[model samples]
Target: MADDEGLSNEVNLQQRHRKERKELQAQVQKLKHSIPKGDKRKKKEITEQIVKLEAELDQKQEKELEELESTTNEPSKVAEQLESLTTVDSDDVDVAHKVKENKPSRAQKRRDKKAQEEKEREKRIQEETINNLMGSRNVESETIKAILDKKGLQLFEIASDGNCLYNAICHQLQQQGTEASNDSLRKQTADYMRAHQDDFLPFLTKDNGDIYTSEDFEKYCVELEKRPVWGGQLEVKALSHVLHKSVEIVQAEGSSLIIGEEGKHCDSPLCIVYHRHAYGLGEHYNSVQPKSEETVDEFT
Candidate 1:
């Protein structure tokens, strides 16, 4: 009787495990289908969750099956006792068949194959994207380096933080005997933009593609002043005006920009290199220095 009770409890536990696993599998499928298109970051996060859940379910099922097998090693004795005590029905025979037939159904096999193909396809696309990006970056870096070499200049490495643009500008300023901190420069840039709202507001836009309202402009300035927000062409223009100096951005290709060309200090403009793929994150900037100024400890 005790052996029968133990076997029954084990069967019930297995059934519960199967039900929970089915529910989790259904949830994973739903999450996959509901993933937002073109949102790579969100998609990656969801994919991680799905992978974690699948791993946990597989591990739990394996543990439960191992335990069940260990406890039922004397299956012959249990079967003889059950036969002597109770009349086994067709349901018992069906359960025995299910336990023996551990292989997945044809439908499940097809689903697994489809899932594997999709996973491979995604992996291939990701690899190709990375390869293309790396190839493009290498070409750009070589082109920029050759151009800089011809001009007797080289890249001075800058930190890849959001404040890279401001830091690059500060480096140039410091080289020219003008000491300025990144925080001070950010404040000055924001102040210039705020004071010249008419000049900057038209160029800025809201998320919905509308021109920035006065409130939006104020909020932008506040964020720029207080946050480590990335500076772009708009900020470059404002900073040029604030510093009373021209800002020249040299790029790998195309015509480089020369902001504030009419400034009094245009002769010795602040020179910085713009890289579309210098960093994995996104756009980056580095100050330009004379090749002769390169030091042993300085990162180029």
Candidate 2:
């Protein structure tokens, strides 16, 4: 066995099975003999023992037979011992019972659901704010891009404090600007970021995400006034246009006579084009109503 790598190990298993069979047979015979022909107590003990031994014997026989038919060299002496773990007889499961026992109680479930809903509502608001910022016309692309590229604790720092880029740019254009100061400028930037958290954070993600200009940020702030709706589904751009006085309109969806002049796309093509400038004349950020659907007139 030490020298041969591919040895057929069968005799060992056969011997083990034979030994077990003999032991069980001996035990069964002893129990059968021990029971006094008319003694009730001794007969009960013998009967219980006989039942146990018979079950064991049946199990051993099945295992030994399976081993004899094996081809993959699995050990036959320790054949798999399988047993029914549960005594459940029915097919239908009592969901309500399981829910009562395994799941959260009614009050706990309500609390959990409330927490989840609140979280989702906050998230939706954040999403809408970001979209409004992206769509706003007040801010510039380069300014937003530079802010987003800034990394590390600097983001938090700026958010808490603010940036002086706008001020610096203004000063430079006036020809009264000096070199950008490290400490002072960073502090200013941090202050600005902190002041405009809702505007900036919504558009910012370290990875590929929305980034908006100062105008967009302001627009979002305006929308915060008389904000409509249950949650924030509308993006910051739409919010800024309506809530904040930002972005101009090139064309708008004028009313049509078709279908009783319903709305845009009712009896016309999408002719609405808001101006791409800050301070749009009459942009309103009201709740976006669900579009009305139409039905075909059927006749026999």
Evaluated at residue 196, the lDDT of candidate 2 is 51
lDDT of each: 0.82, 0.38
Candidate 1: segments with Cα more than 4 A from true spot = 1-134, 265-267, 295-300
Q: Of the candidates shown, which would achieve the greatest lDDT relative to the real structure?
A: 1
Clashing pairs in 1: none
Write down the TM-score for model 1: 0.56
Candidate 2: 10-residue stretch with minimal lDDT: 152-161
lDDT (10s digit) by residue, model 1, range 196-267: 999989999878999989999999999999987778999999889888889989898887789999877655
Query: Could you tell me the TM-score of candidate 2?
Result: 0.20
Candidate 2 lDDT score at position 137 = 51
lDDT of 2 at 183: 39
